[model samples]
Target: MDLDVAQVRAFVRTAEELHFGRAAATLGISQQALSKRIARLESLLRTPLFLRDGRGVSLTGAGQRFLRPARRTLEAADAAVASVTREERPLRVDVWGHLYAPTRTLAQVAGRAGTWVLGHGRDLPSVTDALLDGGVDVAFGRVHPPLRAGLTHRLVRLEPVDAVLGADHPLASEPSLRPDQLSSGVLWAPGPLDRLDFLHRFADRFGVRARTASVNLGLAHFLAGIAEDPRRFALLPADVPLPEVPGLRSVPLVDPTPLYAWSLLWRTGDGHPGLDRLTMACAAEARRSRWLEYDPARDWLPEPPPGSTAQVYPGSTPGGTRADAPAP
Candidate 1:
């Protein structure tokens, strides 16, 4: 059990070369020194590993079995050394989320903490997958899947969403607008598939298939669509600030169907002072009231606006069978 590795190497080299001088040369030792090392190894092992003959040597059955295990022991020892070296490096925490929203908030939180980097995106699934795989530290998203390994989630915000339109548009003049009214006009609703269903149902309600003019995935494109074009409007989530587009206005989307409720997620068992503080700040922002509550619900209005294309109620959204509504 305590045989020296140097002794094992001496035994193997001599076995391969079958000559004292050649084995000594291979080991960078004199022949007498190598012979002495081999002798000590045989004694420790309590058996002659090689039988000396007139011109060469041969291994005992025990020597052959021992050769295989000795080679494996050397390999295992080398790997163990390499693995421990990697453990000495600093911990790398990878954070991920919406490029803009979390940037302002998560940074003010994570920066005060040490050792991490943030990756940004709107693709929730990819971000979540990265988090599960230990590739990302945390994600800000509208939807999160069921909990599994290495993940801990918290509801961050019940993200409010709004539908916007040009102030001069025919529909904007109504106390409440129906989706069918905009059927003939081209639609300029934004973002990807998750939110696109709202516009789809809006079109379906009218019985007229509406043409989507463009898919504006970025914030600037969504705002610019409203500011420049009198005919275009976009529905966006609440976290995004309404741009002060001079001729534009936004209305609460009576979604007919609600989509994502934005939230934040992280790995469990992590200890960081900075993130904990930031989480509290975000909670405060959530606690503060926002725009949608201020808009008068149609039900609460005492008198309906005259010449209205649709009946106005102050407290309620339009609620007939929206046959045109699309599944979220």
Candidate 2:
């Protein structure tokens, strides 16, 4: 009997997420539709794949055995489609954390890279789904932990962060401020603190109280809001071009500078030629600009993936390791 590709895809995604709602959302289908597909696949195989209960869902013994083959089947189907459909299309690249302007880093290397298209993802989960479904070929953002299987990422840059506040603020005159010095002030965030992973982790690690704004108009508006209140402060990449908003001041954060980590993400088995070109450009630019330098004693970064600092490209050294990472 022949297996249905769509049904197998549904099963694979459901196994990965372990939640019908999330799996359906990722697949851009209704939960009922996903359930129907799974049911049909189970009927075809004459075995149960998932044990569902009020608490959650778990893979059955049959599911555990079918998962690997299911993933291979999906990948084979994708490869078959890509062999003809992908030849003339440019690599589709997407990014998240637009507030931080992740494109700035990409812009530096794009001129030297291959032809591609750029898009924006709502958040990490949205971009992750796009990557898994082959909608996007590459993505750039802060790579948080517990990433699903069949995906990989490379640490490309460790950008220094700056603290923005009003010129009239008490600590504004200081040449540089430590993380603890700003603890007494409010940490202004573009959105809810829980949704902004980097900012949330920063505040937690530094013991700073975070407050969210009702809306984010743009960088100028956001900074102006911070400038309006003496107790309000925000964090941004040092390289982000600040609009000349009156009373706006950006001061370097010192005594363990907070570093924003940027990483490139893609599917594990994708063989797009542009992927290599983009990664090579990242490695070259990273080496030229010392983009990956990280000194644990003098810099602060959210926990990174295991062995992420060794190099930016395979068999190539870009020097992000602590031993060779000099202070920024």
Query: TM-score winner among the candidates?
Result: 2
On residues 1-328, what C-alpha lDDT tens digit does candidate 2 reach at each position? 9999999999999998999999999999999999999999999999999999888999999998888777767767876887888654577899988878999999999987789999955588989877876667889888877687878787778899999989888899999999889888888988887778888888888888746664777788788887667899999999998888998888999888998888888888777778888888888887788887665667777774345343333313644321112111
Candidate 1 residues 23-125, lDDT tens each?
Answer: 8998899998998888898898888888788967878887776775665454345446557774322223343334225454444345444444555464555
RMSD of each: 19.0, 7.4
Clashing pairs in 2: none
lDDT of each: 0.52, 0.81
User: Over all chains combined, what TM-score does candidate 1 have?
Assistant: 0.44
Against the true structure, whose lDDT is highest? 2
TM-score for every candidate vs. truth?
A: 0.44, 0.70
After superposition of all CA atoms, the RMSD between model 2 and the true structure is: 7.4
